[model samples]
Target: MSFDYEKYIRPGKLPHIWCPGCGHGIVMKGLIRAMDALGMKKNNTAIVSGIGCASRLPGYIDCCTLHTTHGRAVAFATGIKMAKPEMQVLCVGGDGDGVAIGGNHFIHACRRNINITYLIMNNNIYGMTGGQFSPTTPTGAKASTTPYGNPDPPFDIAKLAIGAGATFVARGTAYHANQIEKLLVEAIRHKGFSVVEILDSCPTTYGRRNRFRSVVEMMNNLKEIAVSVQAAEHMSPEQMQGKVLTGVLYRDNRPEYVEEYQKVIEAAQDFAG
Candidate 1:
């Protein structure tokens, strides 16, 4: 069945700012498709984003969206979820926005197991910020700041989220569009903190510096390196090198923070009575 994506897009926000051949558009489409499949009402959903190329997504979405300050989208989303626990809050951000300056907030949100979905577009560079290297930028990859090569090792967003106590964690790539949509649906439905790290391409910035001939080349590279979780288990460590495992990496049904807090409040009232 064909989905009328226009219903979820802000008509006046056409002509998005993402560069040609950028993978952010594909990720956005997956998000919209997942929401549509789940029958999510725009009014009941709140999309939040921080500053960066990927953060611009909320502007184009027709739902209740918050384009927040750089590295603060997660904090703002946490507040929204706490204030209205019933609202389905989704936070979108880029590699830099989510794991660089926002690193503290990101980890805490996972530790608390907040009932919110966080989609991190890991394009490996800060495309909007003059193509600087980001936390997820692979070690030895050239960027605006690292003209020679980045000396710092990259952070695996999925590993970080899982280690930080996220209840659900998964990964997907722009090349696997259908998988991205399915992962988003699962993340959104998870009751506790859920993080989906999307390996996206920034052809204009990251690709140009990394020697990708075209956006298609970058996407094909992602497809080549992507392995399913089940397949990865059968592969040796050497075989897994440089390969991104896609699919649910971790999941646990811990008590969601908001619901647990509510229990505390009720218990206190009962004690007073």
Candidate 2:
């Protein structure tokens, strides 16, 4: 597939640093395709990332990218959006960075309904920090730190985003490359806060010790488990158990953060003037 790489990719950054079979590359491809579909100007876009293997996305995209501190992409993105409302801001991070350390900011960002798209590449474990069991690591999954199987239940990121007031919420896996791109495009076009939880695979860290034959096998497993929203609607509780839902889970047209702030400013001005 020939894409206008010059338009969305930085020069000399070809061949990203991600390990072989790492789904971050596939996820980045989807993101670039979505940007192309949206016809968004690279100059007018900002991609922010927190510390993690998935945080390397901003470095590959030709935009106003910020590789911020651990679990702080939301705060950085919020500042970027507030400073330049006209710019389209996208936040990228891993499950641990966004849902664990950055959980507070993530919730607040959803509550604010800021015009930003957050892409969380969830590979189930903390890939960057040596495969520790993260907040999204499935219960009973074994990580380096959880050699005996994790005792804690993992977080449901999509539900959390929706409950926190995110206007648009979607889920896609790296294996479903085309669908991931489509969902990303929709998320970017949405006017309010949007979150797309991408099920990615970390072969070296999360896959090797988890009994996944290879990255390919893990991706195949994701395809097997993912179900579309349309399919989920008719699925019985027994049938839906342990299945991950792909596609848009929820969406709503809500007043954006900046727009609401503007309204408050106007009202205060009217009272004072």
TM-score of 2: 0.97
Off by over 4 Å in 1: none
Model 1, residue 165: C-alpha shift (Å): 0.2
Poorest 10 consecutive residues of model 1 by lDDT? Answer: 128-137
Model 1 per-residue lDDT tens digits across residues 94-136: 9999999999999999999999999999999999877999998
lDDT of every model, 2 decimals? 0.95, 0.92
For each candidate in turn, the TM-score is 0.98, 0.97
lDDT of 2 by residue, 24-121 (tens): 98898899889998898889999999999899889988999999999999999999898889999999999999999999999999999999999999
Which candidate leads in lDDT?
1
Error of 2 at 78 (Å): 0.8
